[model samples]
Target: MGGAARVRRGAMRFGVERRDRPASERRAERGGTGRSPARRRCVGRPIAKARGMTHSPLRVAVPLGGTDRGRSGLGTWVQAVLPRLARRLRARGGELLAIGTPRDLDAYAAVLGEARPETLPAALDRAGASAGWHLAALGRLARRRGADAVLLPAANRRLSLGGPPTLAVVHDLAELHVRGKYHALRTPYVEHVVPRALRRAAAVVAVSGATRDDLVRHAGLAATAVRVVPNGVDVERFRPGRAPAALRAELRQALGFRGPFVYYPARLELPGKNHLRLLEAFARAARAGALPHHLVLTGSDWGAWARIDARARELGVRERLAWLGRVDAAWVPALVQEADAIAMPGLFEGFGLPALEGLACGTPVACSDTGALPEVVGELGVRFDPRSPEDMARALATALTHPVVRRRAAEEGPAWAARRSWCRTAARLDALLEEIAVAPGKAVAA
Candidate 1:
């Protein structure tokens, strides 16, 4: 029995000896060093040296699969920044990976084309299923793709518990500030899940200083953890201009009766958007014969459409209110250009994008004094108390009747907006990503 055991052990030793040949011997048999340059350098090498060679072209995975169809504020950010961001990344031997459902890919096709886009399975298109995929499969996908980090542009709504070190963009804590901004069921997720996720991120980007402050104050995040990168407008696209005659004629016909109109392009939402108060203000101004311009409302109905319509009718300004519904995004700059004034009366805003767009279009802007509107609109905005119909009415009346206000906006608004260009936003974001990538114990090891 001992001799048989010795024989078995001898055979095992011989086999192991053959498999574990010397590196030189193996290399000779393989006809020279068999590993690729990257593999050769990486094998048994210091992680820092290996990382310096193999981690070239740093990759960031961006998972996007919500039903927003790239129409929300984040969507606008993506549209404005992605193309520029992609170019900058490529310049530095990095790439952007956009993974999303077919619908999402289609929604931002042009902007997304700048990145390496991969489509998620159609089954993961629904909201619940998509969220689950993001929670479960995102990390796996990042690993398979060798992504160095994950970039969640709409991190407030989408995030993963596990992934490459993450950079989360927090647009607002609107749910915490404005009651009923979202469904009651969703409020808890925002209150609990979102804050936890934001805390877990390697970095957090707030689109406005106000949003950054909210993150620090409400989310219990350290001020150092949050970086303020304000949203930017595509000044080239949203600059002062009239629609071509054909498009102008189309808009005129769509409105039925339109001379000069006051434009307020925001999602139709309640106390959050302050649409009701703005309607009341418009009604008051119209009734008092202080305002002659029709109120042009654009955007999809969120939850307050019925109330807004009812109030407009009740105030007897229904005819004066032209509900253009959600017009094409391409039509927005022209709509602003031809308007007598732009009104953004949201009670609370993280970054009042419409106000910025209006300013970019060289249109006189009448925006709320609260939140980021004042910050975004600067001295150009005719500020008003969003909660007070009287103040709103006064601002609206001034914007419409004051030719000096209109002329000054036409001259200065474009230049002011030019400073907040998408190019600058993209540069800041690129720098942030680079910093995150090379930070010790983060993405650099990957």
Candidate 2:
């Protein structure tokens, strides 16, 4: 009856392929870095360092076990960090194995060349259910593959109960803020399963200080147990520039928009993402006629989208709003560049990736003062209370008005974004993993 029960029916037999690591330590090097060349073409500074790995080689696997592409924020985090991680590990004479569905595996292949994906018991694939099964399964496979440690790149609390040292990445504890939003089994999993999982990890990586704090307060973990490694934008792709003329023309025809627009690119998650309140604010701006910009909402329909659509109609922004569904990561830059401003009115976030991405593109950003947003947004954009539409409307209006001061902030935004580099994040994370692997008297410390 529950999601976990179904996956249990078809539990997997851990027969993941064999002999992934090199027999000897005479390797050359790993893949370079993660930032795509298209983005790099504009800003030549590489975000992934080419520094060789540690003296003692350690096998590492960034399992996609709990992270799904496109379907979750973990997807974005992986797309940004894993490639660089894979390379850094390989440079250290370590192997990086991907464990996920065929599609998820393929997504990482381009960034991590030819590292075969591992799987769970055959029956579990059909069940297509996630009840933290992958958590245990991945741990077992990592041990079998002789992995020194495993990195769980998603925010899910599900974790491998035992086996190799594990590091879990916590994005946010939104489930606690908004009760009754997730499915029946999921609620229990997060409340019970996650804290236990955090305890199981050798160490934990929090995307922001806020997230690190939540882990301590909500999960009852020690502050020393968590480390803050904020997310970084792909400055190469997100920097200021128009879309390819062809791209602009194609999008114009499809969306039929004639004026500059404000972008709110995030999955349509309910009160959690605060889409409804944003719509109300946009409606107020429209009524006042102070801002004539269109509102573009990209990303798939998550839970409360019907409510969002209905509210959109109520606010009379149906005409001004453009629903682009999900935009490919490749196109996010042009989308941000072409916009008048980027709006992130989420109730909570571990790290506001889109807001940073917008700033990297030299576009003004308007975000809520809650969560890690205020910290991430800093003075780059206007901050308002996500609960008040009047506040959001005013922030949106000021950004669109294009004041000289705001324009200067937009102009200086990219350099500010560049300072938060994936290279730096990766270096810090790499050091942490090796610290866990080589700690004396224990394989890892929590």
Candidate 3:
């Protein structure tokens, strides 16, 4: 579809009702300085401003073209952080120009009502060509808007060192640590291409301290250049005890599991996400009569899905397994709240969002002790060894059956999530950007 048509479609999809207005009024609303759209246009190019449009001190260009249809953990981070981050930047006499394909912009517009988004051609929507678009067009787009810096939210995937002054957010280095996380062809990009770009960035934001350490140790990035910025959850939206009984009933009926269940929200990928082992643990617990709750898995399939299904069947626990493929975002909070417990059996997690979300909903979480899960969950989660099914079954039992542990999680989870709000995250990010924008030369040198 054409870019303009996609924008219109996106606006319509989000219930952005259109109203006809005078051209001058529309121009005024868009911050144009009393000039007609045609008058400001340069014939061959799109016009961002009139002859005298006011310029914000700090204009940051955010590229979302490489973000995969707003799925995955990276997508969740973008949706949660960008709206708050945009508000923070605007409050300080700054502007955020989000660049993406029309569909991506549409997704952002749903959350960010006042976002100033520029559209890229739909051809860049393909995975392989996304980085090529960033390499060739991102800098030009930033330069057109006089952007002070470019913030790459998923920098490990899409990066352009030639851009104004790039600030990269590295979510995880899981592919480097976990074998078969990426295909053999894509492994080299994660190993070489991503690290090389991180080295040249003006500053790199690691989603967790564990990720920061990994960058320093494995990627050879300077510790000083890498800053640890943890991802935050929406406490208001994900708070405990608010989900209606109707919603819970609906969720239960949809999953075809009427009894209590353990919710594991993650992609069905092997070795890295470790769903196969989770199945084994579930079967072990079920057979021993140690666990009463059914296993409910929510996420899109990423290869190894067949293996997960086959393993469940072989273990004779397929009937007890509820695979709600790729759950809707609106249903996530209710799903978490209604579940008996949350399970994350990933081999390694840079920052375990499910653990945080589960805590926020007052749902007890049983997650792997490895990676940043320990750091995020702290004393709240029921930690276990991911490699051992015995340990996982034990943790799952505690989270589901232990009265004292469940009560403590229900009472304390909300407060724990409150401390890690998106507001605080945005403030920290604003400060970091301000520092880099204030002294670009020094930032680049470092």
Per-candidate TM-score against the hidden true structure: 0.83, 0.83, 0.84
Quick one: RMSD of model 3?
15.0
Q: CA shift at 328, candidate 2, in angstroms?
A: 2.5
Taking the tens digit of each residue's C-alpha lDDT, what string does model 2 give over 78-178?
76677676666666567677776666666665665725467544444432254446554666777888888777787464466666777778888877766
Off by more than 4 A, model 1: 1-56, 440-446
Q: Rank the candidates by lDDT, best first.
A: 3, 1, 2
Residue 80, candidate 1: C-alpha displacement in angstroms: 1.4
> What lDDT would each prediction earn against the true structure?
0.74, 0.68, 0.74
Highest TM-score among the candidates is held by which one? 3
Return the clash pairs for model 1, or none: none
In candidate 3, where is summed lDDT lowest over 10 consecutive residues?
40-49
lDDT of candidate 2 vs native?
0.68
Give the per-residue lDDT digits (tens) of candidate 3, residues 225-307: 78776777776668787577877777878987578788899988878989888998888666555456788888889887799
| Residue range 123-231, candidate 1, lDDT tens digits | 8877778877887788789878988878888877887777677888878878787887877876787777778777777788888777877888877887767877778
Best by lDDT: 3
Task: Compute the lDDT of residue 180 as modeled in candidate 2.
Answer: 57
